[model samples]
Target chain A: MTIKGVLFDLDDTLYDSTTFVDRARKEAIKMMIDAGLNATEEEAYNILQRIIKQKGSNYGHHFDDLVKAIEGQYNPKIVTMGIITYHNVKFALLRPYPDTIKTLIELKKMRLKLGVVTDGITVKQWEKLIRLGIADFFDEVVTSEEYGLGKPNIEFYRYALKKMNLKGEEVVYVGDRMDNDIIPASKVGMHTIRILRGKYKDMKGKCKYEVKSLREVVDIVKKLIEEGV
Target chain B: MTIKGVLFDLDDTLYDSTTFVDRARKEAIKMMIDAGLNATEEEAYNILQRIIKQKGSNYGHHFDDLVKAIEGQYNPKIVTMGIITYHNVKFALLRPYPDTIKTLIELKKMRLKLGVVTDGITVKQWEKLIRLGIADFFDEVVTSEEYGLGKPNIEFYRYALKKMNLKGEEVVYVGDRMDNDIIPASKVGMHTIRILRGKYKDMKGKCKYEVKSLREVVDIVKKLIEEGV
Candidate 1:
């Protein structure tokens, strides 16, 4: 299996997304308290946490709910302030794992094609890559927003394979999700590598390879190359 | 395992939640189009679908995003109207599956205790039961909001067992989600039944029983009672 191209999931695969989100959430809570949320810091923080658990992490109205809960009315300005603070803190804190850049650089040295096949808004995905200073390492970046497809859809994987001008067997897809990354990639005959972290870590699925960190991916790629896989 | 109690998850377990949500979404899109947004019905529908996929079903600001995308500004009144229309349609369409009430009535005849162990806001969960006209069928109703716990947590399952005054083995727990319901109920020593509907139908997990509908649960409970489980 001569792996010609390597694709990755952006959020948790290249960076510690959970930690970043947690830290940013705490910061946002503090900002909310400071911005006349009418609650003690601890009270506001707990209120936000409760809202997150109830409405889920992706819930866009959490800030609105928080304001309404504490102040008995929806305040757009407060919600906007909270969202801005949250994203600003999150982006400011976003950094790739220490081995991420080095591993990508090493893989690039092998003349292997690298790409990112991630499910996210185009601008946000690109921003993360640029912020991490690894945008130049990849030959292609396919985001769901731009590609008109998302993970678990084999077309999403095929798009990257097509762009790299490589067959599925000639590519390796690495991500933290089983259903979204490993299963779909494997179905397309691409080698799938499961990174054991993030929300989907406990999700059960079959894959060709598993690794704990990006550093370990370099070793797997080297082994694959040596075996002509 | 003398099945003295039967616990159920609400939502898809009792009714076709997917169908309800789909209908409600279509109605909401219609409402959005009629409320001065500049788009055709089809365009509005697609926008809502895209927003749902991008931000997730639980996203609190989907209407805000939809209005901003189509109208170039966020109008709180429009978002509120969208939400009101969506929920109104959903609740109006909320009806239990045909077999749901009959199955519960039959199960109740056997002198076994009935309870609802659900994860959602207290008012919402109760509203579903009340709307289904099955509120009195349960001897107990334990929701995550009031109980301070959610599914897959052993504590959440244990709370139901305690309330029923029965050991885990004496209870038969049925739900749609393998990770959130079956696994945790099994962990707590309850007889687990996976109702095969909902987003998690394909999730892999170990359970003592699997069924297609609430009607099948009555049969399982009867068998358990006969076998003195």
Candidate 2:
């Protein structure tokens, strides 16, 4: 099939979400201390990180759960401080990787349908695109919120294929995860490119392409078109 | 007396606090709405900006007051969201002006004491210097919190002079405000230079000198030493 479209995972594929998130989290802890939290910055951050690890980043109410864990009950002052600090810093520091914009621009010149298939809150994923100043670049955005299902679900990848009105073999799927993003999309019969960065960089994943940066995605797409892969 | 030191204001003079604070405020309002505030971004920002104006930026409870004013009573969820959102964005966006570092470095090479004197919470002011990575450049940081007194008060200027162990005439004071910074320091017999930027950019202030940027301060100090003024 001829390659004519590209689908992307928002977080690690387009941007280095890990480093900024780390700085924002630390700043949040410092601000929590400033907001009358009883615990030290180190103690509070360690506990929060533990909770995030256990509950996952999107379980909702991480701060709400964190304050209860720390103080043995819900404390409005403490919980609010953590919530405000974490998100404000998070969004303020939001940015795409250096190569993301140029890569996207180059892909657009290829006359391809560009879309985002992300597992995150609908508004927040949209907020990420908007803040990164790349919202207008995409033709469609498919979030887990819209389907009430997320990655690793074979149907989710199929749904994105349908949204772009293209067959799986006609497009390339690029993301940074093995279990949920790469493997599942590969099963859906799409050309899958796993960006070897972020949390899953060390995890070995079998895919059509294992590249280090977004810039390479453009060339792969060009080669696929020329070779009719 | 020969000039031997320089004292500066923390905000406007040392950095372009206005631009960053404005961006951070707008981002805070956007995040607040995401956190479940009922108002639109424009409405929330307008109300918050008004509150900051009325109570002044240093008012400790702007978010708490905003929640009360908006919902007609205290709502912990909404209030906490605003509080966490505003502060997190504010601190994340903190930055120094482009010329601030080079000017400080040049002045340090000339062996000036290089101190900061102005108003606001001591800890918060210290946080600014630290976040901007310019804390080591200053020999002293005198905030209103130290003496429970702020600018426009001649005694505060005198206190800064005493701390540096130099007569008022032997030091140069650089600040953006005419009333609180320039006039008082001038009254105390110091050389005063007003940076023509920030809220006071257009206001005509009578001082020993006025300049468009911090870069000019280095030249002024050089001239002072050469002519022994």
Candidate 3:
């Protein structure tokens, strides 16, 4: 409907956080081993990734805790581990999928307010936004670290709508997660666009729209914007 | 109710996050003015707090964004602003109410599995648990940030039960927010306890049980745990 604003997700929607995280996890494991941990890189990587998968982000495992568990103490080792892991995984490898830039640029030209609603760590996520050089492209960025709440929680969606100064019906939320992203945004009356590329291999739901890639966002929004429904 | 597990909320239920957040907001405003932003500490505090209140925690004019806005670029000034604000607010002022620690210890002594089901940011929240020296008290922490979901969404409660390796009937979920906490826990087949500590004065609902303090939790569960039905 009028389409005053557009909200997008960061990881797995625009850029591939999985690859960056995988690389980071590998480096972290190496750092742990270098710091005298008995576990192999694969073992540490598996444990870290498992934590993220279960807890949503590996950073939840405080670097200090891991350092203590691995090194028997918390000291510069934790900092080194965090820094090394961060450098390895930090947005350098976060290649936005083909057509993401063009889609965002096109959306900007259409004068639609842009925002990001991501369930990501604070510092790392913002760093990615800046590094991608897409920081200014968004009118606002709503990260879970800042929100104290995350997706699938109506509070988060409501916050984004209020920040964008748009009602649920006036904005469209595009994301990849059916359980976390799509359902919550849709429940708040915001139209949802599910990106098909990420984890959803057999996603089925009541989404307002779906696209195979970020490139299709423009066309989908254009058509939906024209409908004014 | 063989109280297999007891889940507590971090902010305002076990500890008052509002007080901590208020302190942090005030400190952040001071930092902003000290850095020569046009806004006073009071004004800046009001603005930041307003953003959280009107927009929700994950929405609008984040501390980093605010620092960037004032400095006219991305700088550590914004990062430091948030760090200091959250630190002063949370670290200095956040404290559990009377008997909070005692109650938790008692529950632990009774061999009740303790967990935390909170709609709060994972990083800072886990920090709070550690700061309060109560991190070890919980068997699991189902933070919204970590879970990618929050209360009022039944899945969050269901996940908590799963983590506890107990059915909904086997555990009791407790929190302050009626809409976001108690009712949703009830819908998932978990018995609920509503703590009306006046923090959630606006909270309204018909919950299974209500108490003024967490001290009541032990008694409530003690009675319910004995009745099989």
**Model 1 per-residue lDDT at B53:** 97
Instruction: Report the lDDT tens digits of candidate 3 across residue range B99-212.
Output: 789899989988989988877666556656755768768878777866798877889888888888888877888888888888788888778888876468467677768888
Summarize candidate 1's per-residue lDDT along B63-92 as a digit string, tens digits.
Answer: 779989989986543555577678779878
- Report the C-alpha lDDT of model 1 over A98-183, residue by residue, as the tens digit: 88899898888888899998876655566577667787688888877667887789988888888889999898888999888888
Off by over 4 Å in 2: B1-229
Best by lDDT: 2
How far is A21's C-alpha from truth in model 3 (Å)? 23
Go through the candidates in order and give each one's DockQ: 0.01, 0.02, 0.02
Q: Model 2: per-residue lDDT, tens digit, B1-229?
A: 6889999998988887888788877776676677567788887778888899899888987876776777687544455455555566777777788999999999999999999996887656766776688877887778887768888888888888888898998898999988888899999999999998898777765777999899999999889878887
Report, for every candidate in turn, its global Cα lDDT versus the true structure.
0.81, 0.82, 0.74
Task: Give per-residue CA lDDT, model 2, range A174-218, as digits (tens).
Answer: 999999888888888889899998988888657769899889999
Q: Give candidate 1's error at residue B166 in angstroms.
A: 1.9
Query: Model 1 in CAPRI terms: which quality?
Result: incorrect
True contacts kept of 3: 0.00
